[model samples]
Target: MAERKATNKYYPPEWNPKDGSINKFVGQHPLRDRARKLDQGILIVRFEMPYNVYCDTCKNHIAKGRRYNAEKKSIGKYFTTTIWSFSMKCHHCSARIEVQTDPQNRDYALSKGIHRVLAEETKNDTVTSTYSMTGDEKQDEMRNDPFKRLEHLQEDKEFADEEKVHLIDLLEFRDRLASADYQNNSALRKSFRVILGLLLQNFCKD
Candidate 1:
């Protein structure tokens, strides 16, 4: 009798469609904690194989295939929203990794916690560095200063030239609007009204 043919069966690994595979590269960074407070109560844990996972105590890369533990817990509140904190422990060196994510959006980035006073101070510094005076106040200063007045006149000339070009274009458009006979056709009049509104908006922007 002929020998029975060998039989083989193959089975594919199980995968969940809802929760996809974790990307270790993106998850390795500590999540921002401030985001959790701004967002509602949702959080996402991301994981990936580390290209450079240095040990906290020894400053060496954590070995691959080693198991690590991650923990998430509610920390405190910012305003009415609750903040959550996460920590990961390295299996080799007992190093603790910490990150924070927004509770509202799992992908939201965490921001540094700064009070309103500090934020205002920071903005003030930025404004002072970039601009010497406010718009109307600066114009008044230029009026009083001869050298600044001359500079302002030159700027005004440049602005007038740009406005002249825009006016020419607007005149051409008005000619087209006048040439179109909308008196006999109601639809044409409606279309002209829409175009006129757009042109007026453009003029306002200028």
Candidate 2:
């Protein structure tokens, strides 16, 4: 039985690594926690693109709504969080794209060559913007760029947060809350609790 078992063992004949049956598992290693470990040595984050990105060279599309295995790099540090830059190469054209983090608004902006399409903006608007951009101009209209200038936000500045929020929204929330009688109305009580919970949640996070 031992002799038969030994005889049944199969070894490759000469140099036959290309053989499918024997080489199926060869060089096929599964990576564990690849998304988290993609930052390599840097303590960066990993996120999939939220929108499709266009490759300038090949005129191809890198679809969004999925994790592209792209590594997010830290460009600078804020009070408690680090400002990040997410970058990836276009699959078709191999063009490098860099998207930076917006500090104040907690959003992202294209630091290099890419654009996010909003529901409000139309195809014509994008076409006009493309035509208007002559020399690979950077886009950071709504972005909070800390390195753009030497001073902090003021009324003279263009991208100022303007009291940290719009006045209309402040008035609206204030009016709604003022009208609500939480002591007498069950709905108002529930809403008050929910709003209190949200405030606490955001405060703890900050």
Candidate 3:
């Protein structure tokens, strides 16, 4: 006699679809502890290239406004608290840099880079008049600015040629803003929209 085609004829009713497989569902994952792959135990974290920092090895610029691969490592623990440090490598020179969270001062300190660049902190904001986004929400807005690739203030031949950004603030504001000093000592005299435009400019440093 011809053998009957093999099939799941003897499969358990629970293993067959529409045969009450839903009740037998087990919440198991194909992968284990996926968050641990990110770093430590945090599933999500943020790291920024804060300044137009120069690579020590190649003297190339690792400019601000871009995200890089970062590793977070715990240095110590105070009772139940832990100190974390964010480590980054210069894409150009492979020079390593670090910034650490200082819970005592409630600030961050960079161990290996010249200075930090203050970046825009805006977005397709809704309900600004009635309710404002705060903290991480506000920050997320700026980081995702839609016009960051548009014209840049740093591209102004007048300003780019004369001014330099420094640790505390602009290094040569006297010269950089001299032309606009009469306009209330402002380096920029444009409208609020223009101000927003200036803040989001992506000045590529290559």
Question: Which candidate leads the pack in TM-score?
Answer: 2
TM-score of each: 0.25, 0.36, 0.33
What do the candidate models score in CA lDDT, each in turn?
A: 0.53, 0.60, 0.56
lDDT of 1 by residue, 1-206 (tens): 23445554232355343544332223332455533533554444443322224554545565433344445466776667867665565555565655455544322222322112222332223324632545566768887999998988898799899999999999999888777657637777889999999999999999
Error of 2 at 137 (Å): 28
In Å, residue 59's CA in model 1 sits off its true spot by: 41
Q: Candidate 2 residues 28-71, lDDT tens each?
A: 31443444454463433456775666656676666776555466
Arranged by TM-score, best first:
2, 3, 1
Ranking by lDDT: 2, 3, 1
Q: Write the per-residue lDDT of candidate 3 for residues 82-167, one digit (tens) a residue.
A: 78887777776677877776665445656764344333421221245643334565445546874532333334554555544452
